[model samples]
Target: MATIKVGVPSEGDTLDSPVADRFGRAPKFIVVEVDTDTGEIVSYQAVDNPGYTAGSGAGVKAAQKLGELGVKVYAGPTPGPNAYAALNYLGIKVVTVTGVSVREAVKAALKELGS
Candidate 1:
C-alpha cells in the first residue's frame, strides 16, 4: 500500500509544537508519514509555508505546495475557500482536528484514516 502522508499546520518543526489555527497563514507545516497497518508515525519534517508571506491567494498557493509535496491528507482547522477548492481539485482529503499540539492533531488524523 501507499504510504499515507499527513500534513499539519504548525508553528514549529517538532510534533510537540503547537498546531497553527490558520492553515494558509501558518508559519510551517509538519508532514508526517504514517504506517497504515500499525498507525505509527514513520517520519516527519517541517516545510516553510510560502503563503505566510503572500499578499493574496495564499490559500491557493499553499494548497498547490501541499499537492507538490504529495500530501494525501490534511489535518488542521478549516482552510479558506480558495484553499479548500484547490485541495478538492487535487484530490487531497481534509480532516478537522482540534488540538493544542501538532502531535495531537496527527494522532487525530491517523485515527480518522483508520490506521
Candidate 2:
C-alpha cells in the first residue's frame, strides 16, 4: 500500500494541463499521489508556486517547498543550479520533461522510478 509522491510543475490542477517550462518560476505545482502496488494515480492537488515571484534564490525556495510536501520526484524542465543542488541534497530525483502534459510527465517519472 505504499504511495509515491511526484511533483510536476504545471499550468493547472489536472494532468491534462501543460507542464511548465521553468521549475522555479512555474505558476503552480501539481502533486500526484500514486499507488505503488498498482501503479495507479490516487489523487492530485495544485499548489501555488511560492518562488514564482522571488527576486533571488527562487530555486532553493521551490526545492524546500517540495521537500516539505514530501515530494520524492520532480518532473519538469531543467531547474536552476541552486534548485538542482537543493533537490539533490534532499535526495529527490529530478526528471526532465518537455512539450508534454502534466499527466504524461508524471507517468514518465513513475516509469523511471520503476514503480
Per-candidate RMSD, Å:
1.5, 1.2
- What is the Cα-based lDDT of residue 4 in candidate 2? 86
Instruction: Give the range of the ten consecutive residues with the poorest summed lDDT in model 1.
Output: 106-115
- In candidate 2, stretches whose alpha carbon ends up further than 4 angstroms from where it belongs are none
Error of 2 at 31 (Å): 0.3
Maximum-TM-score candidate: 2
lDDT of 2 at 22: 92
What TM-scores do the predictions have? Answer: 0.94, 0.95
Model 1 over residues 1-109: C-alpha lDDT tens digits?
A: 5478898999899999999999898999999998877878889999999999999999988898899999999999999998999999999999988667888897887
Off by over 4 Å in 1: none
Question: How far does residue 14 in candidate 2 sit from its true spot (Å)?
Answer: 1.5
- Clash count for each candidate, listed in order shown: 0, 0
Error of 1 at 73 (Å): 0.4
Please give the lDDT score for candidate 2: 0.91
